[model samples]
Target: MARMKKNFITSLFDTKGKSQDTEEGLTKIISDFFSSIFSSSNPSELDILKASKGIKSRMTGIMSEALGSQYSAEEVKDAIFGLSPTKAPGPDGFHAIFFQKAWG
Candidate 1:
């Protein structure tokens, strides 16, 4: 006989010091936590330009042109199909096989 598998969050507290244990409450708490982390704090455009100026570019004219060049549909398909089908899924929860199979 297999042992019972127990997986769950017993409780979670929100910023208000309130305890949340229900599914909806827990989902809201978790969603809010991640949202806060990814939410961007608007920065000034001048600040961005100033910071970018400090960075040095190593790319040559030829390299820059090659990187900026547009790819043909056949090239794009080849690049995607070149990836190993059995590799792990990407951050988007999709494996290369997904793209290969979905390619039209």
Candidate 2:
């Protein structure tokens, strides 16, 4: 029989019987929650690329904050271009430039 693994959050709140540290439990709980949300609905390549552009912009800001310098426009462009796309978005609520252009 294969043993079932409890989700990170489940384990964290499982006060029923367990000895987990506060930080470890909380970190897993937080990570699991965000991972679940991000993984919930996979978007398309273009949609993901558009979203990644936003994320890369934020990352550049964080990098600039830590390094005390803003990224050059070219650097930002390169960073955004470096990001790869996710799988095709499913039928419902799926939107992509390629799909629209191709179908239209």
Candidate 3:
């Protein structure tokens, strides 16, 4: 009985440790993905969050210049990904308001 209990606890710890590692790996992937998105012509997360407050933010400016004046980031994202705005979860659990512009 004692050995069985020890084995059970060890197995549980192993499972927990594996899950934690997986979660960390996923987080890193998410960070890397964001980095790639902003690697060229686009600003980083800090820049996006900074521009979240205005109608004429960097993202908006890009959209207006390329996609047209009425283009919004949400629309651009949807068009690119073929999904609704909600499909792309923002980085760090917060949305970065994007104004459309073509730095690309």
Candidate 4:
């Protein structure tokens, strides 16, 4: 049997160049760093409806209806075939070539 080794942050340096090894000190240092990054000054509020009042959509009713319609089998097959075969595998661990060859 093989033994599993665990790794963790043993120590961290604070902004003042002091090493923090205690749990509380490490937590405080990390929290302060993230807080400094995420905190915002002079935040502005926007009214979305007022901002979008003058913006006009370019799509026509026919175009909208076509977009909402279901795709045909030929279209789906074409899309699969259009993908590059040498590309990296998807999240399911299968490449585009696999699908193209299986269903081509």
Candidate 5:
């Protein structure tokens, strides 16, 4: 089956309310609009460190757990085979049936 052609909008209004015809002008307008909405000023260093201090530090534990855990091929095979066969193929055009058969 042939896919339908997608039409792109060519013009945009800049921050100065001026019409922009070129792609670069549109991109600049979008960038300037977003930058204006989401100002660059962020939380200070002390505030960041203060927030992180209360959160659980799991990296060290997770790394150790991962190193200690044993990998099982059966678990991977089970997971692949458990996928829904009725579901459509993903963007790569590969369906779960492919993995299901490959796993077996």
Candidate 6:
């Protein structure tokens, strides 16, 4: 039996108090809003760069601990085989099950 699809609230407001209902209009409004925010000049580069060192060092420490561990071939095989064959592929269009089959 097929399940009935629920309607979503796609209505959005534009910058000049304008209401958007069409898919294209909603997409354009979102693109314009995010583009404007991203295109704005950043004056806090120095502050952001200084903040990176602390987080970078902490992340590197965590990665080092994991990277230092040795994994058996059976462990790698088990991990890949655990994924369901019917699961959808990621954006790269390569399904994870492909790797599992390739291991044979």
lDDT of 4: 0.88
* Local distance difference test, candidate 2: 0.57
> Model 2, 7-65: lDDT tens per residue?
33333553344545588776776687688877847557887677767553445667668
lDDT of 1: 0.89
Residue 85 displacement (Å), model 1: 6.8
Of the two candidates 1 and 5, the one with more favorable lDDT, higher being better, is 1
What TM-score would every model get versus the actual structure? Answer: 0.49, 0.24, 0.20, 0.54, 0.53, 0.44
Clashes (candidate 4): 0
lDDT of 6 by residue, 57-93 (tens): 4467668888888988998888778878769986788
Which pairs clash in model 6?
none
* True-vs-predicted CA distance for residue 43, candidate 5, Å: 6.5
Query: How many clashes (backbone N, Cα, C below 3 Å) per candidate?
Result: 0, 0, 12, 0, 0, 0
**Which candidate leads in lDDT?**
1
TM-score of 1: 0.49
Tens digits of per-residue lDDT for model 4, 1-104: 12333456779999999999999999999999999898765444555566777999999999999999999999999898999986999899999989988994
> Tell me, what's the RMSD of every candidate?
5.9, 16.7, 17.2, 8.2, 6.3, 5.8
- lDDT (tens digit, per residue) of candidate 3 on 2-87: 88887642211232354224655656655766877868775488886777757554566666678655778767666645534344
lDDT of each: 0.89, 0.57, 0.53, 0.88, 0.80, 0.80
lDDT of 1 at 49: 95
Give the total clashing residue pairs for model 6.
Answer: 0
Instruction: Quote model 3's TM-score.
Output: 0.20
How far residue 56's Cα lies from its native spot in candidate 4, in Å, is 1.6
- Output the better candidate (3/5) by lDDT: 5
Residue 45 lDDT (model 4)? 54
Task: State the displacement of the C-alpha of residue 95, model 2, in Å, after optimal TM-score superposition.
Answer: 47
Q: Write the per-residue lDDT of candidate 1 for residues 8-52, one digit (tens) a residue.
A: 467899999999999899999999999889776776888779989
Give the clashing pairs for model 1: none
